[model samples]
Target: MAATEQEESLDDLPPSAKLVFKVLEYNGPLTQKGIAEETMLSARTVRYALERLEGISLVTEDVYFADARQNLYQLTEPAEEFTASDGEEATCAD
Candidate 1:
């Protein structure tokens, strides 16, 4: 989807999901447990937040090589997508 669409989708999500997204954006890929710890949210809440993010295609899940039993979550867009030629990062609401 377009960036505008993504922004709109993100706006529609609950605050918990938005927090989770921001945490991932700043911390890079992490396991569900890591997300919960970073956000200070419960595991169940983090799971729901991840679900919402995945539903919007904003997040992707992959096997965590270090632990096959767990999965790593990360933003779909690379860091470069949020960076301009001049090296400024895009705002979340932009």
Candidate 2:
């Protein structure tokens, strides 16, 4: 898909979700706390946004260790398509 088209798809997301996407886009995989810290969002807010993004297949959660309570999140293809270029960083604006 074209960059413009991909970007348009992301336009529907809320600011918090877009912020989470941006943080992941630039910093690689991060745990929910990491996202919250980077975005200055509450942990609960970050988790809520991540859950919404996950439902739309824009983000993925992977359990790094069975004993760990939190999972790391990475952007899915659609997210990368819109928010990254050739693995280079991209920014999302509110």
Candidate 3:
């Protein structure tokens, strides 16, 4: 899909998911606990947001080397460009 199309798709995501995405975009990769703390969102809410972001191919998850039990989440390459090229943070209207 084109960049514009993917961005449009992001617009359709829930506010929680959009907030999660913005957090990852600015903070770099983070584990679920980190995301929950940063966003002050419940663990279940963070997990749900991560799932939605993952489903849309905006976020990628990988093993967290520091803690084997946890996984790290970050923006996918294409998703990174969506923000980097624009030089602005995507707004999340909740």
- The digit string of per-residue lDDT tens for model 3 on 1-94 reads 6675456567888899999999999999999999999999999999999998987788999999999999999998875534645677766456
RMSD (Å) per prediction: 6.9, 9.0, 8.7
C-alpha lDDT score of every prediction, in listed order: 0.92, 0.83, 0.89
How well does candidate 1 score on lDDT at residue 82?
72
Q: Write the per-residue lDDT of candidate 2 for residues 1-94, one digit (tens) a residue.
A: 5664455445677899999999999999999888999999998889888877886678899995843887989987755546676777787777
Tens-digit lDDT track for model 1 on 18-81? 9999999999999999999999999999999999899888999999999999999999976666
Off by over 4 Å in 2: 1-8, 78-94
lDDT of 2: 0.83
- Cα miss at 40, model 2 (Å)? 0.5
State which candidate, 2 or 3, has the greater TM-score: 3
Ranking by TM-score: 3, 1, 2
| Residue 49, model 1: Cα distance from true site in angstroms | 0.5
Q: How many clashes show up per model? A: 0, 0, 0
TM-scores, one per candidate: 0.74, 0.68, 0.75
Worst 10 residues of 2 by lDDT: 1-10
